[model samples]
Target: MTVTDTAPRALRTPRADRSNGQWKVDGRAALNGTEEFKAEDNGINVRERIETIYARDGFDSIPDSDLHGRFRWWGLYTQRKPGIDGGRTAQLEPHELEDRYFMMRIRSDGAALTPEALRVLGSISTDFARGTADITDRQNIQYHWIEIENVPEIWRRLESVGLETTTACGDTTRGFLGSPVAGVAADEIIDPTPVICEIKRRWLGNPELTNLPRKFKTAVTGHPSLDVVHEINDIALVGVVHPALGPGYDLWVGGSLSTTPRLSERIGVFVTQEQAPDVWHGVVRIFRDYGYRRLRNKARLKFLLADWGTERFREVLESEYLGYRLPDGPPPAPAVGPGDHVGVHPQKDGRYYVGAAPLVGRVGGATLAGLADLIEQVGADAARLTAFQKVVVLGVPEEGLEAFVDGLESLGLTARPSLFRRSTMACTGIEFCKLAIVDTKDSAVSVIADLERRLADLEPLLDRPIELNLNGCPNSCARIQTADIGLKGQIITVGSGSGTGSGGVQVPGFQVHLGGGLAGTGRDAGELGRTVRGLKVPATEVADYVERVVRRYAAERTPGQSFAQWVARADEEALQ
Candidate 1:
């Protein structure tokens, strides 16, 4: 007995009239609003069914209604190459798609992991995922090449270690993100571990929240550095202090980035550390009830927030949900940097936390297993996944620092990497993602390698960090909008219609964004990158263009000028 077996599938909102016996939910979105569609009609309560029925029956056993939609509720996405042989992905119909191997996203809320959990993740990746594993910016590990038959066993292994794929995708409370150094950071205002655990405990499998108009993302962090990316989540409980209330959270609502990017706005309400979970529950309830259910793209809480604004939204949360008025609270500290959290930094305790920079978040199962072993060997209790796709090993004693560093180096993870390597980020691109139009990971790696070789002599000039982010599509999966060097995918014809050597060639390319950064006085802050008009880089020439830009910055920067500052004062021509 599940939603599929009992809920009123024919029910429609009172405001809407039925058409052709289907609930035609109306839209408020101007872009893609007119067309009516039913999100729930896609499927109902398929998570457990996937394990109990679909996995046992094989891929063909899944009805079309489930394959394209219900499958995602359990964190399964068909990792198909939608656009074969260089055609536009969007132009193709569903029937034209190729391949059925799935991608499984394992939610790791708060970047929290135990060595035992790591071992489970690693073994699963190796045995079932074709050695494929990636640590996402959301503090999750995604595996490509997952098969239908193996999902049940994967769930068993994962659940044995206290991990789950539930609500990791598909319009539910997708997942929660917390500070990687939540309990361990020296300057943390509060530890978010308890809150993260509380959210999952209360809401993870609650059917009331399982169906939503679209995805909902939430982050809770008390770290002073704002390490959990409060501004980009639908609902973020950022650590703040109310003068009378002492330590609590400031609620932020509706922040998200995709084709339409909006920073989450602070709701001016202070929620007690204990009340944070309730506030979260209430806000999600609000999203579920009143959020746009028409257009899938407009279904995010951001759209609802946009139309309602925080004033009314807050009123509803107070009057209907929390049953108490939240008091005004101070804003969280402005981000000091891009919040990379890389390298060795001291914790409140005497021990040090070393953030190891992986190669743009790509690590094999063997590598992850080795990391787990190193954590045990080095006397560290846990490892954290940072927002920028890096690992921060916690509780390493001062005496064990040397051992930890050596072990990380042996694992191809380094305590200190090149500035580019540490800050570089890329999305899972055309290699696995269906929406992607270009290759991101391989191109990013090549660019980083080329830059490292060419800029060997320029290291002295890079007194501060620079971020290079690559996204396979305009969806901003790599946080491309805020990158110092943002590369968004597209197809471009690079010359006259009759030519040689990349001329008149329609190939994968990236739109160039320069000087984008989180802002600060000399070397810190947050700001979106400026787009260079008429500038796009072919995939093959990404390295060359990036090298030229960095070289120019090195040669021309004024005294004490950071990359962001240099780009601020630099002419657009000079940047290009």
Candidate 2:
């Protein structure tokens, strides 16, 4: 079939069975797998609808599908704020919700940024969004408290800086991630920026990809840290060297984490830097035509990759999409350190790039704007955001290194941070995210501060870096399942005065998981976190409990035993 023929409509007409709430094929519910929505022509109509209808008519104008599904294409979502309960909220109409504001997201194809772009971002947040700005795990800027009236202005500002919200949140080829230190890293195998630009140039808002079974995610990284979380995207181009081709990308398909967590599998093909975009196009087209569209939960590219396996997926791509075979490639280099670009690193260009960490990826408009000034003042050519929620200022001259570090420090952005401060990650919790269960940003800040204070004496023995991810829910948007210490927000009953849940009540707490890590970082990476039975910690006491566990690990660990290895053999009682 031609590329145009790969559209979802050209495929079989879906036969829906919605007896189980949503559309279902065999008693299993689907996302928007109903024949009705699929038969509605195009999901992209929301763009015109928003401009002509919704914006003109306010919140009440949103149709159910556009409110929940189509609005995402423009990076808009009605965030259910505080006082909005779990039940009934999901079923309620967007206008019926207490808060009518939207959470606006701006897509960055390569996680790349510039001073002009950031100023626009900061302006949008401070001017229109009430100073609420967050850098998401996917390396995009997210704003809350946005209204329909403000969207036009926001889009205008964004467009002025060469940024767009199109396909940022929809069931299309959402934002693709690239290395935070893409062109500047000293140890990078290859720079993937050009490939990312090519992909965006060809398919940013192309209508052919606007309608898919479900949302799609992609990442391309050449850094040794595996900077983009390669194992967790639908299609990832990881840096690898071919025996004859030198530096190129190794292809991986079908990685995702939600209720079902699966690390991507390498497809064993070497794609030259020039050929990367075509390969990407081929894979996504294959997904469009052959992917499972019958079940929402099962419609991710991972499901197709899982069922087809890497070999078959590659075979179809070669035969149906690219019409040519690709050369076999080698595996990515093992990770040397954490992917977050915090701290100072010398670039290959004899300059320095500073990766400064903001508290748990939470930064406001003025701060981001201030950072834009710093980037410009320091004579840095550009700045980029890391998947780790850190920002990297690139092209700093050697003379400006000291000034740059001090400037970041002045903004409360840290170049050198404590292990706990550097390692902690938190998702957008109950504050804005509708799916979140508890408060995350401040709680994470509090927990990290507490951990830093109480564990001060243990700082010397903290040789092994720990990954502590606090996700407000089990959605894994923060990749909680792949962290060393994963905290899934929940309301757990503490029978008596227990750790954080010590109020003799079932309050906000976390279901703790241990031993998870992304692959290629340490010698032993890429393992999912372990779940212990009845392992729940009150949010208030999380720091204390984590301290106790770390102390025990330090004292009891065998020589060279990583946290995951120790957790594998340690007595079950010691975990608590």
Candidate 3:
């Protein structure tokens, strides 16, 4: 159990500092702040300024078991209703905000900007009160509500423009995710922005790999296509070539999807690009020294490679990388092609990188500072952020791709192509998860805007792309069994009294499931369909029964069928 005897389990503070709380700090006040000041307030230590702002940013003062201070107090404050907390509580405004936690990660065509990073992200939305700044599904840029004593003056104005909240979110090593058109796409095969800037310069602020056993994800794509799902990642490298092992990368290993969904295990060999950080420090020190700490539902790292299996977790990660020497490379060029930075392309230097569509990946803070002023008026080298929430701007110079798609449609932002926010995904439910039970992002944008206005003229019925995923419970944290119309929220029973009243009683709803798919040949694990009783149906008649089962699979499908292979050739009373 070593890892200092599996810590985590003490944060319950908040005795009405406007309750709905959390607070903890100590460990030399989280490492004496210096990312440009603010940890020095020293008012007799509030757990030493939250352990010196988590050790001046490097982290790991203690606390593990997936240390949840409500994921660092709602990713830095925004729960109000008492004389409206911090940013003057506008019950909901900024463009009629339906709370999609702001997003925007600009760069592609504007080539990785800098004017001190757009004047430190426009002075962190003009002196912290954040109110909007998002672009993450991994391309990075998030700054929603923000306000917990203005997060040490928004971390001293995002370290005076250099920008950083440090490893951007717990369990460390986050925010290094690459390929929003890395090094200009045009079927690129190996560029991954200098190995994602040397894996964010040796694990951004490494304090001996900041507390683990969970929440560690990594990816680097070199574009052998496979559009950045980078095998869901516990560690993924991608890009290939290897005519006698040359270009590098094919690692993969323990993919994930909360509530234990597995799907990433290839272990043993192929790493080049200079032994990708010694195979990422021998698979994160064999999951921080033999994973599983008495099971918090099997602590991740794909349940320690499913309890030491993948050839004994690659022989204890080659006996703890016995002094590193493994890079003999070779084996890794068997058809790793096909790219999808979604839409428009061209860039081996000639320049171009569009891929817009931000719908369900929402965005606001003035469209995230007009996507960082269109990467400071085009020129940040390149900018990316896909995993399907979309952004991809890159080098663009075919005469500035029609004025950067007409300046992202005059800042209302949209690169077109919409089918209810590209496949939909909802999580921060019960209005900011206290382990939600409903309201998953306004019932997944009101059931995908009533099933895209009732399948608007049955738009080519099905034939691919269907993922729905709406987890308010079952703690799947929004992986909803790899989605294909997943749902999961359960509590049913509409009237007949005794379940309390006021808001017209009858509690929970949404159990659906249906042909869940994840695109792994067997087409993404999906089943358990039927359970739509959200108080006798009304989430737009349960999205009009999944849009009349996709218009009866577009009039009895065939021809390259897919919606989970035609819900596996419908049966069981035609899928209920």
Candidate 4:
């Protein structure tokens, strides 16, 4: 199937004509500032400028338009400076908070990596980014401390390894998330590797899709584990079998999180493997043509779906984009395994794949390089990064399994991680993200260590892992709203202190959200966590609070009651 280069219909609709191409309403005749700037120049055009002008001339050569707006198109962002506390996050301007260095995101489409590719990533991190790298939830590798002058060489190295930063950020199709064990899993319904590869080849660098109303995320998964967190992406295709058509994908759309969180709604469409790429193209094009654009906050596809609803959306997609109707089909079967994929698992090929957990996604360049050596020594050829911020090394034979596990442990990766370590997730917080209001990676690490020690006795009482997601802001970059214990970071007033009539000291803290979860936990659909009134957890006391609430759940839960179920039924007093 061919994705056309035609401009989206919204660009030439009656609304566009009325506003003389500005696409405004109520005779306002004014586009949002960001939209107006994008119209002046395509964000991709900055790539040439970055290579030719900024790389040689240095960071000061970048104008504000390109620095703040266009740079994100290529996955570059100015990281936050050290020593800046959460209290000052809102008081200072961006330039004051930002460091000269950049954070570069490497889009690992399908999260697959060869030994050679892994080495290159390791070397780049060590040589260019001060040995710092993070495995993001969307299955991309993020590096910090990048300089403008080093970007060209970094891009060259990534391209050599068949990886890229293109559309890894900004208002474009971000990295496509697939099941980490896409092709090798023993019980996968249908491998999505081919569909993922085809979609990337056809539309990855296409200029037509480089700009959208806002970021568009996509996920495809064949694993019953539901490993891609499909319920919260803009468009997701979960593997399922049609009653008569055999195995295919079920379409879900409009899932997102932030200050306003929304679970994706299935539009009752089934897609065959052959039609997957075309179906994805059609859905993205529909989003481009008809999505909200006037308000930046309202530009995500979720808002559009909320307004149009699923039935009208399906009709428009078929008529305007696909030119054909998709058959109504069944939703996926309930997730049967832990989505994180931690520990050893058998592969369909009679070999084994080992899933290892890194501490809250933190792995240094040296550790990664060492992991590559272990993979080669163990005769493994493939590795994948998971949505839960873990790594799976594939193709290990029975003979090398013991040695491989030892090697992973040496590199500080654990195939057998504790429940707390396996379930906790954190975003880049005040340490690197300019928008973050609190520290996340370090805070999460501390909490994990504490929980492991404190919750050891209660392990037998738990049947499922309780997801603890920590975000540095209300933006929900860590998928906080869909975690069992979602923490949105903010500064809260606490304790009577000098210089205050109301008497309080400002401290880094979180607003707690309980019972949020996705379909992987066996709920019929994704559910957002509910917030309790007047509950604020200080950053320092996260471990203490989590321990208290968990112990309470363990004591009070009935037989076969999941943590989410307990939260749903418990009184407000029990939650605290």
Quickly count the clashes in candidate 2.
Answer: 7
Candidate 4 lDDT over residue span 533-571, tens digit each: 767898999999999999999999999888888988888
Backbone clashes, candidate 1:
11
Candidate 4: segments with Cα more than 4 A from true spot: 1-30, 496-500, 521-524
Q: How much is the lDDT of residue 108 in candidate 1?
A: 84
Worst 10 residues of 1 by lDDT: 1-10
Provide TM-scores for the models: 0.90, 0.91, 0.30, 0.94
Clash totals in order: 11, 7, 38, 0
Candidate 1 per-residue C-alpha lDDT over 289-339 given as tens digits, one digit per residue, 9 for 90 to 100: 777665565667877787777899999999989999988788876765446
For model 2, state the Cα shift of residue 106 in Å. Answer: 1.0
lDDT per residue (tens digit) for residues 1-576 in model 3: 001111123222223333110111112222212201212221112334444554354334323211223233113322322222212222444223223222222222112544455445556665553444445445555554443334555555555545555544444455556666666666777876676566566765565565444457777777655555655678877777666766778777777765446667666567777667767777876675555433344556776675556676666676656454454334333333323355566777787777776655555556656766775576644344566556666666786677777788776556655555566766555544334545666667777777777786775554345767676666555556556567766555455564556335545566565555433212432232322222233343568667777777677778877665666556544443
Name the lDDT value of residue 82 in candidate 1.
Answer: 42
Model 3, C-alpha of 489: deviation from truth (Å): 3.3
Candidate 2 lDDT at 484 equals 73
Residue 60 miss distance in model 2 (angstroms): 2.1
**Number of the candidate with higher lDDT, 2 or 4:** 4
Please give the TM-score that candidate 1 achieves against the real structure.
0.90
- Compute the lDDT of residue 232 as modeled in candidate 3: 62
